[model samples]
Target: MLTGLNVAVIGGDARQLEVIRKLTELDAKLFLIGFDQLDHGFTGASKVKLDEVQFKEIDAIILPIPGTNHEGIIDTVFSNEEVKLTEDLVKSTPPHCVIYSGITNAYLDKIVQSTDRKLIQLFERDDVAIYNSIPTVEGTIMMVIQHTDITIHGSKIAVLGLGRVGMSVARTFSALGANVKVGARDTAHIARITEMGLTPFYLDAIQKEVEDIDVCINTIPHLIVTAQVISKMPAHTLIVDLASKPGGTDFRYAEKRGIKALLAPGLPGIVAPKTAGQIIANVLSQLLHDLVKERKGSSQ
Candidate 1:
């Protein structure tokens, strides 16, 4: 049980509700920041403003999946007030206080480093990424259906980056009778794509491969789908860039070329917040439980 643990959940959407539910059930003391407009209440959670939280007593801090923006501002959908995470606030926390986030930015990373506190980016874990890919694949399917008039069956699809999400996307689309082609730099990934009974090509050959595909899906977080790459694609092809913000595809170029390009990041959260939240909550509960045990052992 996390009975004695004091956790501060700061600024998130519906997913954080699942985290709050699990944490409260474990009997943790929760100070909810930036949830002023939330109608639902939890037993052990106190909805308070940022100033009201006793930072020194905090055993853990939970930031939203997106963490802070470049300017250190967190996205608080439930509150009208601005909840900024400053270095001073992190420094005020107990030495052992852990900060949990789905991802981190340069701003948040610098704060945790200077404060000498632990910062865990939950999405970095393989288990989390793989599990989250399920919803991601489903969301991808949803997007394709919503945007394109053509059926997935027998449509030529190109998936860039053979990462967990890319792999799932390729497999699912192929299973649905789409002529799926996956691009990757690694030889092993190429062989794996072939093993999955799909066409495999190097990322460098993306321009050549895009010539005939009906849909182009990019999972690479970087700018792999540049103007040159998109220029080679058929005008009728639908481009789905699933990377983080400022995704792989060139939005301006795609628009100029008269191709429909959609940038979709955090599809799991949008498509299945409850499942995504439970994935985070389960991992966090285990990690927090481990933290408590470790502290107890050291004290004894």
Candidate 2:
């Protein structure tokens, strides 16, 4: 039990509710920041403003999945106030206090490093990424259905990248009878795609492959779908980019060419908050428990 542990849950979306519930159940004293507009309350949690939180007493600080942006601005869905995480705020925490986030940016990295604090990025774990692909694939299928008039049964689909989300997308679309082709940079990934009975092509040859595609899904975080690549595709092609913010697609070029392009990141959280939150909460609970045990052992 986290009876004496103090945790501060900062700005997030619907998924943060599940995290709060799980943490409260463990008996941790929670100071919920950026939840002023929330109507409900937890047994061991209290909604508080950022200034009210005593940073030195915090054992852990939980940040939203996207964490802070380049300007240190956090996404606060339940509050009207703008929450910014600065270096001074982190430095005020106890030396052993750990910071948890889904991902980190240059701004967050710099501050955390300056403070010499432990920062755990949960989404970097293989299990989290693989499990998250389930919801992402489901969301992708939903979007495909909503946007395209043609059926997925026989449509030509191109999935760029063979990572966790890309693999799932290819498999699911192929299973639905779509003519799925996956593009990859690594030879091993190309071989794996071929082994899965789906067509595989080198990413460099993407222009040739997308010429007749009905739908193009990009999982690469870089500028893989450039103007040249989009020009090669049919006008009816739908481009779905699942990469992080400022996705891989050339939106301006796509728009100029009259092509429909969508940037969808954090699909799991958007499509299935409860499941996504549980995934995070489960992992977080175990990690915190392990931390507590380690600290106890060292003290003994």
Candidate 3:
């Protein structure tokens, strides 16, 4: 049990409720930063205002995935309160305090380094990424079926990137009898796509490969689908971008060209919050148990 630790869960969506519940069950005293809207009457946790004063005794800090904004403003989807995770706020934490988040950018990393604190990125773990891909792919399929008029069988499909999500998308699409073609920068990935009995094309030649793709799924986080690429696609093509915010496709251009393009970032939370929450909770429990073991070992 996390008997003496003070854990602060700052902000997140529905999945965060599971994290908070699990942490509370572990006997960790939780200080909720921004959850005024949720009055689920959780017994062990108390809501606290986000201010410089609250940093006095926090043993650990947990933030939502994508933690803070580029401007360092932290958004709590469960509440209306706004908290700025400023450099000053970070520097005030105790030396032993650890910051846990899903993904961190260079800006947040700089602040953590400057404060001489450790930051744990949970999303970097292979298990998390692989397990998370299940929901992501499922959500993508759900979106495709919901938006498209044509059946997936015998349709020409183009999937960009051969990463975890892309591979899953390709395999699932292929299983449903779609002629799946994957675009990738790596020769190894392209070869793997072919080995799986699917057509592979170089990402540079993606436009040339797909002239009448029924459904195009982009897993790459950057702007891979430009106007030139969209112009090459059939007007009825449905583009699903599963990347982070400001996804890979040119939304404005797709709209202007009358192509059905969708930017889906957090599908797990939207489609299956319970499953997503459990995935996060399972990982978090293991981490806390490991921390307990480490503490016990040092004491012995």
- Can you write out model 1's per-residue Cα lDDT over 197-299, one digit (the tens) per residue? 9999998888898999999999999999999998998899999999988898999999999999999999989999999999999999999999999889989
Candidate 3: lDDT over CA atoms? 0.85
**Could you report the Cα RMSD, in angstroms, for every candidate shown?**
0.7, 0.9, 1.9
Please give the range of 10 consecutive residues that has the lowest summed lDDT in model 2. 290-299
**Alpha carbon lDDT of each predicted model:** 0.95, 0.94, 0.85
User: How do these models rank on lDDT, best leading?
Assistant: 1, 2, 3
- Predicted candidate 3 versus true structure: per-residue lDDT over 157-270, tens digit per residue: 999999988998899989989899999999999899999999999998988876979989999999999999999999899999998889999999999999989999878878
- By the TM-score metric, which is better: model 2 or model 3? 2
lDDT of 2 by residue, 1-300 (tens): 877889999999999999999989999899999999999899999999999999999989999999988999899999999999989999999888899999998999999899999999999998889989999999999999999999999999999999989999999999999999999999999999999999999998999999999999999999999999999999999999999989999999999999999999999999999999999998888888877887789779
Clashing residue pairs, backbone N/CA/C < 3 A, model 3: none
* Model 2 quality (TM-score): 0.98
